[model samples]
Target chain A: MGIVNVKKDNFEDVVLKSKEKVLVDFNADWCGPCRMLRPILDEIASERSNVKIVSINIDDEEDLAMKYGVSSIPCLVLFDGGKEVNRSVGLIPKDAVIEFIGE
Target chain B: MYDIIIVGAGPSGLTAAIYGRRANKKVLVLEALSYGGQIINTLKIENYPAAPNISGFDFATTLYNQVKDLGTDIKFEKVIEIKDGIEKEVITTKGSYKSKTIILATGCENRKLGIDREEELIGRGVSYCATCDGGFYKDKDVAVVGGGNTALEDALYLCDVANKVYLIHRRDEFRGEEGLVDKLKEKNNIEFVYNSNVTKLNGDDKLSSVIVTDKEGNDKEIMISGLFIAVGKIPENENFRKLINLDDSGYIIAPENCHTNVEGIFVCGDARVKEVRQLVTAASDGAISATEAIRYINERK
Candidate 1:
């Protein structure tokens, strides 16, 4: 499992500037379901260092939520050059993320 | 000049073509751009009967192809203006196209954010339709600003799709449907904040969060990933402002089915006032307008 921690401070540089693919996991710890999905994302991040994985706490970073129109939790946006290319919502199996990245 | 010319290629326009061509009329569909109007932006449509989960883009494409199969002619040109009289003509950027009957199906565009960076993130993080992009935000937090029935309804819909939903309003009260508000409060995932205004969006790439100030002039930051703005939608009736009769909210007014004040002109879809503006209803309106236009053409010619 390869997962990298993405903070609010370095969200842009990691998601937009990185040569590798970027995946943003919009979530918070308080959410019970979010907890179930966090580890899945973490594993994907570690397995694939080429992609940047970031977990966001909606409680502290409301700005990011509104920017992407993240009306739902567990929204994962796959980006390749700062531009959003693909996205998935709700909780699914860890294999789903792996299938998405295809590393 | 064709026997029937319908403006707009959305559900209404394409549906009209299906009926008009079946009536043996020379149906000419003059679309402003490619086939499929704003419906292409929609992600999913559950309310459409028999179609458990049809996407807006796919459904639009299918509808367009269906019209084509019926031998309805299509043109990719934007119609600028229309002149109504004993002879009806539509003015486009290239040249004018005249027809005995015209069915106006030009739909409405969503009211803009009017903010600086809001336009930059239209499809990136900023969106208007939940059925289209809701799945992309599974365990993420999102905020919705507005105080109408649509706003509250959006908050409720997002609750099932999104992780957290923040309901923000500029006024102390909300003006949504009574039953919907009661239904929204029952959900534990929703957070209601009153007298709050969204001042700015803060994020370099996608969206990190938003900066909002409460009524008391206190600043607070709400962190979330998706933002759904259900404030209000503006009708695109500027081109037809002088051509037809409009309601108070600037929507085209049809008397009964698709009949306008003009002799050979008709309208359908979101541009006209109706109870619902779903794909089915738009298609229904298109059919009605085409029938009306075909009959009028037969009588006039």
Candidate 2:
């Protein structure tokens, strides 16, 4: 599956309640690095069937951003069993992202 | 082995790829992060010739595509080390490759504000690129630290979104353009804190305030939701230090011809020690370095 856009209303069901490990990308529309990271995440989403990918637009979901302590764009947080196990900030290559997710 | 292995996907490296491909030589471009490098953060690139008012992202994307269409192999990998010899070996985090020639255009990264808890506070309240994180501080107070064009631009960009912006610089006079400084002076929401430095970052989970100390040693605490650091950039040439000679500032010590101390290894872009580090000059270095690399390979044969 492709990257799922997670909003406040569906964030819990789409991200927190998912059975597989989810990689939540905290991003914004105006951010250049965030836009650059989209294609890499899309590739990951397609290749890794066991994992899930979701994106949160901080502009629309300000409360969710605050709740997650996200103060940067392109912040990737890996969630396993509905808990954030690992997180990486800023733009990184695909191999580094895969290494960050421990896949 | 590839004819040319360019280490960096910025304007200089991408431009080198274009030149190398046009010469009908196998070229591989390795980049650790996203393409475009620091230029991607720039909102408007007015200085680049013929591309007036074009966004930096657009220029970089076009160049990237142009190189891609030419069949230049671009890999996203972090270069850890390089072995210099007749056949140079370029090692990356993922894998390694051998090339007849290598172009080191790694470029520069944001210089950090060396205060306590600065690294820990990243993404919490501190950011290097205002264009990337300024949106998070909408209607909230923020501070910018630097005295260059980037600092002034960040202040101007943040002034429109944040409730208030405090521009703190170590020197009283800004090193940025007079026009940009003048533009910043006109903003009512932007306040200038001259001859000062950020001494401390104050917050637990996130940043709430910063301690700014002036030349007189007087400390002033500025309450803000975010701090954008535009102090300038430092070269990422540590990995290549053993293979190449670097100046005190860690920039590759190369001549105007872009040839390094080691043969078959050329340096270009912001990574090289030069006075003017603009887009045009970088592209110019790319062409010169690629041409030199092509000549070197032909002479070897």
Q: RMSD in angstroms, all models?
A: 10.8, 1.9
**Model 1 error, position B296 (Å):** 1.5
Query: Can you write out model 2's per-residue Cα lDDT over A19-97, one digit (the tens) per residue?
Result: 9999999987667788788889999899899899999988899999989989898899999888999888888878778
**Cα lDDT of all candidates, in order?**
0.77, 0.91
Residue lDDT tens for model 1, A1-103: 3555666687788778878887888875444335546766776666676777777776577777767666456578888888888777655556567787666
Worst 10 residues of 2 chain B by lDDT: B37-46
Model 2 pairs in collision: none
DockQ of each: 0.04, 0.70
**Residue B106 in candidate 2, Cα distance off native in Å:** 0.7
Deviation from native of the Cα of residue B41 in model 2, angstroms: 2.2
**Per-residue lDDT of candidate 1, residues B174-290 (tens digit):** 888889989998998999878988888877757678888897899889997777777877777788889799999888999558898887889998888887777788888988888
Classify candidate 1 by CAPRI docking class. Answer: incorrect
lDDT of 2 by residue, B165-245 (tens): 999999999999999999988999999999999999999978999999999999999999899999988998998888799
- Highest TM-score against the true fold, candidate: 2
**TM-scores, all models, native as reference:** 0.68, 0.94
The recovered share of true contacts, given per candidate in order, is 0.02, 0.71
Interface RMSD of each: 13.1, 1.4
